[model samples]
Target: MSADDKYPEESGRRRFVKGVVGGATLAGLGVAGTVSVQSLTSASGIGGGPVEAMTIDRTGGPAPYGMPQVPIEIDDEGYIRGVWPEVDTEEVQGVEVEIAREELGGLQYSQEWFQYCGHQSYEGLDPNFDSDNYFKSDSAPGYDWQADVKDEGDRFHIDDFDDYEEWGNDVGNSGVGKPATATWRSEDTDNVIPVVIIRSSRMEEAAQESEWLDASTDEGVFAFVNKCTHFCCVPGYKRTGESARYNAEDRVYCQCHQSVYDPFNIVSTLYIALPRPQD
Candidate 1:
């Protein structure tokens, strides 16, 4: 695909934050209105308000919305990388602030999507944070196959998921998808951004039907920030036997609260984003 088929060039972008958001939620701030009020005089950060983001479908649980999808690409050598949005500046409430946003898959995809849950203040969310932008294997993984295949700090390669069509474990039926536990835009920082990458024939089929899926995913590989929206807990895809009890055997399930998400579905969700901590 040409550069035009991908995100806009870096020379001009109405964007700000270009990295995965961090962990932790604003303990007392759940309502967007309350967060907006504090945004006025908090003198603590930049960019906070209601925003729409693409996410996997949240089927059951206390989560207000589904986890945000992370756009990805496979390089010439087959390494997978998360697509970071562009960085630009805009004024909010009369204050000049940097923001990361871009038009993709028929909507405005931005850093704001990952801003809630204290992600706004993470070092990785800094628009200027430098990284090669590849998704790296986590030191520890929920899947035994992943632990046996990849070591800590290894970049994911599309070739690694060769048997995704029939891959299965003790948790669920075979052939749902293959998953990788990883981190994005989190090198050299205390804040580790958890990410989940999955490859499946289902995704390839979906991309053929949806423009958004076609643009954001490649080789049946797609990803999302691994934290649960309800409690910021890490979730797994077809990783545990307990998921069967909740009818989530073929989906992403959060053990923290039994929240279930359908990876086969991607939808839009609206939530208040927290401003990045200004220091």
Candidate 2:
């Protein structure tokens, strides 16, 4: 590579971000490192700590890890919903604490995976937040076609994405996937959990080779938290034509910081999940 292709020296803040990214990459690689028990419990929350989570691969820019995958299930009625794991209490540090945790896709799936970026305090994160756990349409959607097909708060039906096999927009290539914007576990709550859903044949092919993907996704459909790990900014897949400049035209791109994530390269990411507020 030529010097012209290299990024210039970064400032202290950028250096710090890169350092954390490196550590997270190592953790995902199963290179065990030690963190003090005090550090894990220092934060003021109930369940924050190093959590094993399934995420879309972070291929470029400064995000420390991929966006957390939201395990989903399609109902008999053909509506899709995010899977909230079973709720129960566990003794941690000798005190009983309520948590949403269960084994799925060969992993300890838990609410801690979504406990970060201040989402730790969302009422919906409560193990028993009263809602059907369906992915509801956002009032303001990213894709124009979504607004045309469904109204705000309408549950998405699989038939809504019948064109996914040949879906196209002005942003990226055609037949990549069909996308949607929605909220999960947020009905009647002050805080909304932003979510992104995509239906693609590519996912169908990948799931065949991955145990985690097979259990978390269904019929080529999957969802993830829309927040970028870099700075909590929302990112989108094939939403911006400008992503071509960063060579991210076909991936989830965070315009705010030029981060890119590959949807098809899902991997296990060990990330520090923040704890929820005390009940």
What is the per-residue lDDT of model 1 for residues 1-279, given as tens digits with 9 covering 90 to 100?
A: 243221123313212211121122334344566678767766667877678889999987556689999999999999999988899988777778777788887778898888866677888888878989899988887688888888989998988899999999987889889998899999998888889999999999999999899999998999999888887888899888878877889999987666789988999887778778886
Model 2 C-alpha lDDT per residue in residues 1-279, reported as the tens digit of each score: 234221124322445555666776676334213223432554345877688898999987777789999999999999999999999998877778889999998889999899877898999999988989999999799899998888999999999889999999988789989999999999888889999999999999999998988999999999999999877899988889878777788899998767889987788998877667776
Residue pairs with clashing backbones, model 1: 15-88, 15-99, 15-100, 15-101, 16-99, 16-100, 17-100, 24-117, 25-117
**Best candidate per TM-score, number?**
2
Score each candidate by Cα lDDT.
Answer: 0.82, 0.84
Per-model TM-score versus the true fold: 0.87, 0.87
- How much is 103 displaced in model 1, in angstroms? 1.2
The model with the greatest lDDT is: 2
lDDT, candidate 2, equals 0.84
